[model samples]
Target: MFGELTNGRYVTLARSDLSRLLFERIKDTTEIIFGNEIVGLEEKSDGVRVRLKHGGERKFDLVVGADGLHSGVRRLAFGPQHQFEKKLGYAVAAFEVEGYRPRDEDVYLMYGRPGRMVGRFTLHRNRTLFLFVFVVDSDPLPTALKMQQEMLREKYEDGGWECPRILEELGRTDELYFDSVSQIRMNGWSKGRVALTGDAAFCVSLLAGQGSALAMISAYVLAGELLKADGRHQEAFLKYEASLRDYIQTKQQGAARFATALAPRTQLGLLFRNLVTNAFVIPGLARLVIGKEITDAVQLPDYHWQSSVI
Candidate 1:
């Protein structure tokens, strides 16, 4: 299975090919409107009032709040973030770098801290993506890459292949994303007809390397539930929540554990990591720690395309 990615994300799929794949796979009549920000939601007897910015609004059979973390629709329907989100006290920012590689490098390299980890991976054919994450107190605000560069240098500057290189290249990109990795644990993700989906329902901290997968899978399930509802959006929302709750809970719990792994606090923590990494020779110990903890006793689900689902 592929690992999770955050920064400098690129997909190898060519523009036309990617568009074709998406169209063929999801050939529903679901119209996608861009740049529309949801400002408010008022539930009606049969549907929900999906109010958009600049006074545009619409009614839908179902309003799935897939807006993402800091979900605008979430607050409009439920409440503020404080009502659901629990911050783990860390944040991250990621962006691409300049000419740091051979201009043809497409492999990945990464590093980790107790509360943070960074990685890079192949996008498609020729481009490489860079990702960076760090867990810090305060906001450190570092505010910008120049500050992050200073900070990274203070911590891991001595003789690294890319620490310095990354710092130098940090100036090239103006599209950096920053946010805290907190989990959303709600007693109920649905109220009347408006329901939360994806990161709105449960944000499996990026620490678990499964945020994107969860988003994709959760959306698929939600859409399926809607189809099953046949028109009963509320029932579908509740059923979707009930069916996916256990999995979401398990994944979030795993994310908390991952946070600990990234930032080992003690000598024992370091030793424990090494032991797990080398557990093959230790009899049943591998099965005890690494297997269960890392994998969560769960295998990645296959998402092979079936002509029917689309």
Candidate 2:
């Protein structure tokens, strides 16, 4: 059991840490604009004219909507979010705790309750990340951070384990990132010179645990296709979609079902889940349940070298 399941191959890093590392690498080569956001886009024959919220405009040969789940670029180019966003009947609120130490510093600690989950992840020696996810039945979801915090407190106030202490700390935390668990599904990810990437195009939610990997793959394929097309965006966009759409759609389908199983809705379900994982999540069974085949559903193409990078 230990030999089959103990193979070390994956590394997990905080999203902020990864972003900061990438930004440092590209800060010198790219003209990065901070604070302002895209407000509008007008497609033309040669390029797309983009309007920022600060009354700024720029024209580019391509616009990749890597903005995220509630993407402004997706809205400007595709349409409203409701048309494409599929709510998974859950919400997650996340905050960070500085100067905290855990016994197992290298491992992720998680607990699941009926329709709720609380987890702690170590970011570094001094920093820890906390996340609280719960089932929700509300639409027109709460948008304000205060409301999200209040809702999390109200929902998990009586929760067992470390939730109470986490909630207390959450009160003092100044920054909170909250959003409904949702997947964005679109008939197509591109229109004219603009294309969507990452959470903007297809989100497998968090339950699938493949959002970041899939996004990186999307970026690589999109860039490769663009290089293959020699700056011809229409052709590149078509190829990108054709190449990855089926794989993403298959993963998205799995995510929708996995979300429910993540934090079961009933006590019996949770018990069964615990029993199954404890019994089967070992040795050859673990591989059967969750293996490389599931993780590597998409085969990445070997790309030729291109002078330009995205």
Reference-based TM-score of each model? 0.75, 0.92
Q: Which ten residues in a row have the lowest lDDT in candidate 2?
A: 1-10
Candidate 2: tens digits of C-alpha lDDT, residues 251-287: 8887887777778889998898778668764557866
Error of model 1, residue 154, in angstroms: 6.1
Candidate 1: regions farther than 4 A off:
1-20, 23-28, 102-108, 112-122, 139-161, 265-275, 278-310
All candidates' lDDT scores? 0.65, 0.82
State in Å the error of residue 1, model 1. 9.4
Candidate 1 clashes between residue pairs 3 or more apart in a chain or in different chains: 11-123, 12-123, 12-124, 114-262, 114-263
Tell me the deviation in Å of residue 135 in model 1: 2.9
Q: What is candidate 1's lDDT per residue for 287-306, written digit by digit as tens?
A: 45544334433333344535
| lDDT measured at residue 226 in model 2 versus the true structure, 0 to 100 | 85
